[model samples]
Target: MADSKERLASSLLELKKYQEQNNTGVVRGSSTLGRTHLQRLVENGWLEPVMKGWYIPSSPEDVGTTSVWYANYWNFIVEYCNSRYGDDWSLTAEESLTIHSGNMVVPTQIVIRSTKATNNVVELKYGHSLLEISTSPASEVAFDPIYGIRLYGIAEALMFSSPNYFKSDPVNARANLASLENSAQIIRLASVNGNSSRVGRIIGALKNIGRDNIADEVLKFMQRLGYDIRVEDPFDNIVKVSASQSPYVSRIRLLWEKMRGQILSMNLNLSRIDLKDKDSVLRSMETNYVKDAYHSLSIEGYRVTESLIERVRSGAWNPDAEDTDRRNALAARGYYQAFMRLQKSMATCLEGDKFDLESELNEWHYELFDPCVQAGIISPADLIGYRTMQVYIKGSKHTPLPVNAVNSSIGALCEMIEEEKDGFIKAVLGHFFFVYIHPYMDGNGRTARFLMNMLLCSSGYSWIVVPVERRNEYMQSL
Candidate 1:
């Protein structure tokens, strides 16, 4: 029999091997992982069971982590469905439209369709469940894979989606419809399915979004084929938001609209924005810099101090002689530099909101990393923009949008803020959504807090310094 130390060594080696092969730490219980191995992991606090047969890896220190469910939600579905039904399964029409609209939030109740599905709900952790409905879908499906889960193509999804989708997620529905780009696809599907009612709904949706050309083409084609059609506007209100037809724009708009309500009330103590009080504004910003920098850097896991911040601010920053000093000093310097730029931007927004925002936001990212570049810690090529690859939060299950979606999300966010007159909403949503988007690889938290403060400054509110000690509270609120 193996001794305790030998057994532990064997377990550790096996765990490493499993994680390496899978790439994701998630493990199926029966494959290379036995009940003893799993129980050992549970004892060590390195694993959490999502369902009876599924387990997700976690850090021993990270006890009670449920976001693991959200993080791996779709991946688990893909694996589960594929194992059970091969390629004979896909997301239901409504769920497919949800993904197309860029709402990646994990649903509490997920619905899938498969020819070999069990047609029953399998309960998972946190009250979420997988409801798979068996359906005899044709072998050939116009489908796409998002984060591994297969779904109907945008056009097919839009073509088959219920009117309830238009009511609940109109922006998403319209965005998916806009992804169709042409009436030919819809016309073809309508002809093949021979569903005049669904085709009429699609035509109405196209017309509602001002796609007169496609709607007219589709209408004429159906008329030519001797089919009587009536367009159906699903929403009670005929009004449409002035949104670009680009799917990215529509998705971003939809997500922001759905998410904004949660964070709008986070800061309600601020007075009305008085950007005219320039001296008062500047003084408030200056007074808060040391505390702000200390808390912000510390929250980001930087070992920064008041002394270090002052040293960097006082032009006494010389960290080249020592390696650790160099890294910490660079962090302090970057914070100070970015803070100064933020002050200037706040002042400009006070006078007018007409600055080149894209360029300015890019400059903010560049300023934060320029210090790191100078210290030879990061590549200078990335000095001008957001991360071009995926990023995951350290401890949270919430994943950021895909890297490619960052630009459009930021653009839509800025446009929303620019058009709104409410300083409070701007501060709250701007801060929450910026970090939620996680646009930048390194400086997202610092930048988000800076934005929140700047928008607060517009309302004559004092800077709300989130202390390092309250980092847990800050992140949880996010």
Candidate 2:
């Protein structure tokens, strides 16, 4: 066993050096590493095979989780495409628009256009595949230099995107459309082809999202070009229009407007709990603590127990005195502390008073991770604010918003929560959107549950416990 571990460690060191030299997760089978090293790494689950000769860095712990694959998906595409076709390929218009809008959710299948493609599909792990369509690369291709995936420029992507695309994914379409800083690109492209029908839909889509001035510019430009156009809105429905030019904010507001109605229509009973019964509520919450902490912590992949939770709550678990078990105890202690803080905030809401919701949430996040910081398990900087890098959820296709989009999106979501009158709606959408944005690097699931229960408590709803047994369904529903 010692010999095997030493061999595995040596192989991992080699792989790490290769990753550092190449500065990528992707590893080609034909590279300098001999077959023996590749076989050992694969056996130990350190490298995941993408195809016959392609692999990406992974770990044994990530065996069942698709997060590794999703995280490295773009890197594989960039490496594979660059190897096969050099600089001759670009993503299809629809995919380009999706990226341009800052929605990095991994698609089940991505279509690529290239002068050298053979019009075939390259199957990837987790049922994701790449379809290559043979076509002359567009002159207006753009590149995301960081990922090295070529894409259609924003204006070109919007112009060439199918009419059905606007209706099929109005959220991304609306976002990218709103991202057009002015009408110059649209006017320049529309005037070249005299595409009256496409122009008409673009004009209506612009007006649909409350960009009427740009819409008018395109409209007048087309008319002056001696083209008769009948304007038509492509979207089947229009959500609330945000004045902010940010696509991420626009997407959040649109989703909130669209989903809040459904949440309200669920017809949940949200009567206020009488302040006289605050003691009863507190006792009930105390009664539910062990079960709640167990499931919430367990669902987040923490190995915790009811006894550990009880010990932490009763001050029997001390970080300073329990060095041998302190690593395992961090999550329990942090959760207990954060939950207590949450209950106090919830008590304030129970009094029907306004509080700084943002500050309250930040405290919840801080309390949840502060124990880890104190234990030297993670840097204290991690708890400072929202995540500074992209985060992929386990077994989920939904990629959280990029770091650049985190701040504004959170602000927009908080404003919506404050403006909302119904507690149940706030609870439902607040929980949904919080995880949707996935602002934090870790503890998002726990924090989201806290936010949900906080709103629920404010409206007299009993504390809802999501069971670990329903973990799969819980993730899918989110």
Candidate 3:
């Protein structure tokens, strides 16, 4: 019995060593990682099953267990898709552009067009699924070597994408369309495939986005091919999308533009205050802390009461002091710490100073989770950086961007916040984009609300405490 236990521990150590040596989170089930060992590792929380035969490494102390999912979404998909279809599969046009634009949010259903596909759905954990469409791609469909997967060529994708793509992801959609140096490739496809409808849709998208020359050229070339083409604007309206050559920048621009309208329509009854009214605002924050902590913690599903928060704030919190649930108590403590830091951050933002706001938010995220680290609920590394895996919001269809998108999105977000003239937009959108990105493994919502209030303070609005009861409405509004 003793020898068996020792051998299992040895296997665990070897697994960790192998992961470090390979510098990869992916662990495939094999002879060494047998069913018994895999089940044992999962039971101990050191490995999480990404799919039936795959797993990603985990920290035993990490309470928020979705780290592996966010960190390895693409890797798992690429691998799983290959195993299922060999080389006969291609990702859909929209998803390819989503990746191209650095918006790697785990889509609820990844659309894979493949010749050998079963046309079935592969259900994954956390409401994510793989949707296989059995369609034979044209012979001209080319794949990029860098993306490590097969997809339709830029021109083919643009020609085949749904019209709804223009409104939902106009920046990426337009950027991709504008990126094709010439319509020669698409025209060749039209000539070869004799697909007039696809050519017409492409022309409409191009013309709608102000690419009249390309649209006209495509029209002429397709006509020269002796095909009568009918074209209509794919999108409802012709939106002048602003974008530079950088696809990442364009993605950020599109996301901001899309959400800004909703922010304007939000509860605008909150009166604006003077930024110089520091003392008055500080006093109000002092009064609002207890109420804010309770709701904030409650919204996060922490069973914390105002009384418990008051106790924690008053230096009466002792995780080891009683039969109290230490986890909840520590969470309250962390929230108080984060709340205080936010007050200081608000002061700085209002004082007309320029500091690296990114690091400042990093500090806030670290503060929010510091107690969890100390309580041995999560490792110290979880607070040190952004999430590594895909995350899905409960009951929400929107999937956040991949880890690759986090830094660029935040950079663009910070730039927008500083340049915007409307404080309302800055405050509301700042909060919206932060959580939309979901950069951290946990505490994203709480941290976002704090940052929102900081932006609001800059514009002279009081802290808005969303009661726990309205969590559903709040999420739905978002």
Candidate 4:
């Protein structure tokens, strides 16, 4: 037993050194220490197989979850392609446009162009695959400076993407179109290989998004180049473009604009409560406290029970007790605290008191994690603002925006919620986009639920409690 432990320790030390030296998670078989170290790491779950000879860094906690694979998807693609093709490959034009529009959701299948002869599909973990198109000319190729993945330039992506792509994903298409400062790149690309129909769609898309000046410039330039292009609008609807130039902000605004219509169309039978009758809602909330707390915490993977929720809510929870140090107990207490705080905010909203939307939501977040901070489970600094590090959703392909994008994106989201007139639209889109941005490191779901219920209660709709049994269905809907 002692000898086996010692050997495993040495192997771990060697693996640590290798990871530190390489400065990346992607590892190839030939680059690993010997068969013994590699075998040991795999058995202990320190490394996970990506394919036959390749591996990625992981932990035992990631055994059944796709988080590690999804988090490192782009990084592994970069390393694998660079090693196999030596700068001879780039992402497809449609894929490049998707990323260029700041839609970082992990794609189902990534198509690549390579100078190599064979066209093949390489299967990856968790149903993700790569479609390799053979012997294609890799023009307009550029590397993403941050992730090092090869892709097409924004202008080329716009010009080469299919006409139907503009209609299918208008948010991504519109955001990319709005990113252009001038028609210079489009005109340059169009002059050489001008397809009249394709160029016409580009002009129509630009004009659809309130970019008439650029549209006029492109039209005139194409006509001067002797292209008989006729204008055509590909989009089914014209959306008011957001004023902000930041792609992240633009993307969030577009998502809200697209979803708000659907939300309005829903047949939600909201029961109208009188504005002055805040007491009845408070009484009902107190009655459902245990059920609400139990389901909300349990859905978040907390080992919470109705009795534990009751103990916390009844003020029998002892902060200094050793039993209370358990994470589940700490979580129950925190949920209770945050629940109480939300009630107070809901009261103000029901009474029609003017409040700053951002400040109210921040207070809810602070209360949600304050118990964990007191227990030293997390730093108090974490509660000060938006998450400072990147966070991933378990078993999800949707990668939240980066740390730099969170602050401004969240600000834009709050402004939309405040300006929205319909309560259902506010509640539905508020919850959907909040989780989409994932502003906080932890408790994003819980915070989003609180936001949803707050809007619902203030607007005379009943408070909603998502049961733990429906956790899977609820998450999938998100």
lDDT of 3 by residue, 1-478 (tens): 5586686696697787777885555677755467677777777777877677787766577534555576566667776777678877878877777666655555777888888988888888787888888887534556543236576777777776777886777767876765566668678877877878878888888887677877899899888878899997777767654434456656666667777876676756767776677888877888999998999888988888888898989989887744456878998999999988887877776677776678888988888878778878789887787888766675454567656667777787888888888887888888988888888878999989888877777688778899999998998877
Best by lDDT: 2
**Model 1 over residues 425-461: C-alpha lDDT tens digits?**
7777788878878888778898888888887786667
Candidate 3 Cα outliers beyond 4 Å, as residue runs: 1-83, 98-111, 117-134, 138-150, 153-155, 162-172, 178-233, 244-249, 263-270, 274-276, 319-325, 370-385, 388-398
Error of 4 at 106 (Å): 2.8
Range of the 10 consecutive residues with the lowest summed lDDT in candidate 4: 239-248
Each model's lDDT comes to: 0.76, 0.84, 0.76, 0.83
State the TM-score for model 3. Answer: 0.69
Worst 10 residues of 1 by lDDT: 137-146
Tens digit of per-residue lDDT, candidate 2, span 337-432 = 898898888778767777888889999999998888887878877788788887788767777887878898888888999898887788889999
- Winner of 3 and 4 under TM-score: 4
Candidate 3, residue 124: CA error in Å? 9.3
Q: What would you estimate as the lDDT of candidate 3?
A: 0.76
Q: Give the TM-score (vs. native) of candidate 1.
A: 0.83
Quote the lDDT for 215 in model 2: 91
Off by over 4 Å in 1: 1-24, 33-47, 137-146, 241-246, 254-270, 273-280, 298-308, 315-330, 347-354, 369-371, 374-376, 382-384, 394-398, 421-425, 456-477
Model 3, backbone clash pairs (residues 3+ apart or across chains), number: 7
| TM-score between model 4 and native | 0.91
Each model's TM-score?
Answer: 0.83, 0.92, 0.69, 0.91
